[model samples]
Target: MDTASGLTYAVLGTGALGGYYGACLQKAGLEVHYLLRSDFDLVQRQGLVIESPDGDFALPQVNAYRRSPDMPRCDVVIVALKTTQNHLLPDLLPPVVKDDGVVLVLQNGLGVEAEAAAIAGPERVLGGLCFLCSNKVGPGRIRHLDYKKISMGEYSAAGEAVGITDRMRRIAADFERADIPIELAEDLVLARWKKLMWNIPFNGLSVVLNATTQDMMANPDARSLAEALMEEVMKGAAAQGRAIAPEFVQTMLDHTAKMKPYRTSMKIDYDEKRPLEVEAMYGNPLRAAQAVGARLPQIQTLYQQLRFLDAQNRGL
Candidate 1:
């Protein structure tokens, strides 16, 4: 890739996560093209409005396109879309990604990188685990709650460890230039499992019980339940040869305890009657564990509950 200023970036999904990161990059003077949907006209008119704890800012004029085909081929294509909309990547990716450009899967859940690798080629794929608390409150308006760090790593087609690379550092430089903290993960598989240690409990319980992080962490019973679920996640990770330290669970708990009270992305989807990413976030992890003969009863129960609630919410 090129230097932060020289490389052009395309944000494929301009929602909370995409819009916030893309806006930061553009504000830092990087060339960023946003592929917008519902907020296209508004962002094109007013630009993106970011309400962040660090400070509020606005991009008065942005390079916005309603369709991927209309966008300029970029050096880095950031796929920040929700996994539910991933089916669109077949059309959205090829039209905007240069022959040698890389696609950064800035998404949640496990095995999502594979889908992008299939479209963009394995060597041209990277994974980003966004540790951000943000939401799109209105058209072109994104509210950044807390936690704005990303753990990025390269994708290995053979499922082997790809240690830190110059390519990874180059990408990290761009994000760091945008004032975003970047942790270069040596092992992407272990990093994904670590992220799941937090996502599985908070994302699911928040929707199932109608509680925020504050509510869950404040109540003794809810706090205990969350920790128990996290332990099961560790067990599942170990089954796959990823050994997360027991201390990591407490670290996650403490982090969430300090986080601002906010509704999770899954909860927002549930409230909006959109399809929950039950399959990606829950079902996929469960299956992975089961394939290795790991028994995760608590996680299995939560997954089933989310499945039922997702169906009922969507009227499926």
Candidate 2:
């Protein structure tokens, strides 16, 4: 059932991003259904708790469910699943999203929206690049760290020609009304690549060296490696016919230097005995670069290291 606000929202993965965004919408008076896994029972009873530097709040009652099929068809389906859990979407998305529903992918890595487009059709898919640092510290608890802005773009199967369709405007309106800061992107491919400028360096390096973003930036060698990785990402993006500004590399570096000392999501996953998203975060970008006749040696070495590391201490 739609609220007076007129959009029924469904959250596919009720982790940090999903829980935080879904709660934002719900608190703003929109109807949002959260499909939970490990925290299903606790959330169904105690609801969600959000810890943000801006302010903290608790939602004591949420439309929480454990099964996807039990969710109502939604106007907007925000997918916050880690690229690691994307395998479940084939069974989950079709029933939860309405015919004209838009599926927003809030994930890390490149070429991820393609998976959603393949399932929901290209026109129905949208890419959302999240620039927030939040973590599900425990069942029903999410801690929001540094930034919280999302850059959104319409998805195309061919990954060509970006524009702002009426749907994009409406979705942007929906997000804005919920007090979530958003940016509209004319080129989805470029936005994805720009986001990669940060992910490639920090996410993998933090895991491989067992360091935080600040640690990498503070160390001379690690800082140099991060800059080199960012350069390769720009080259790979250009190879794909999408050019991200070179200045973005420095921009990301400066921003991360000022942010709080925090562990990346991939590092957390590795530390928690869960699967690291090597393929989605590192593997996909590597293949994309290779497909475009671009070679990223630094990224390739990082990928191999992550693959081996994932194979080794994953049980911890």
For lDDT, the strongest prediction is 1
lDDT at position 121, candidate 1: 91
Q: How close is candidate 2 to the true structure, as a TM-score?
A: 0.95
- Candidate 2 clash pair list: none
Per-residue C-alpha lDDT of model 1 across residues 71-136, encoded as one tens digit per residue: 999989999999999999999999999987899999899888888899889999999999898888
Each prediction's TM-score versus the true structure: 0.95, 0.95
Candidates' C-alpha lDDT: 0.91, 0.88
* Backbone clash pairs in model 1 (N, Cα, C under 3 Å; residues 3+ apart or in different chains), count: 0
Give the runs in model 2 whose Cα sits over 4 Å from its true position: 1-5
Model 2, residue 133: C-alpha shift (Å): 1.3
For each candidate in turn, give its C-alpha RMSD to the true structure in angstroms: 1.9, 2.2
Q: What's the true lDDT of residue 170 in model 1?
A: 81
In model 1, what are the clashing residue pairs, if there are any?
none
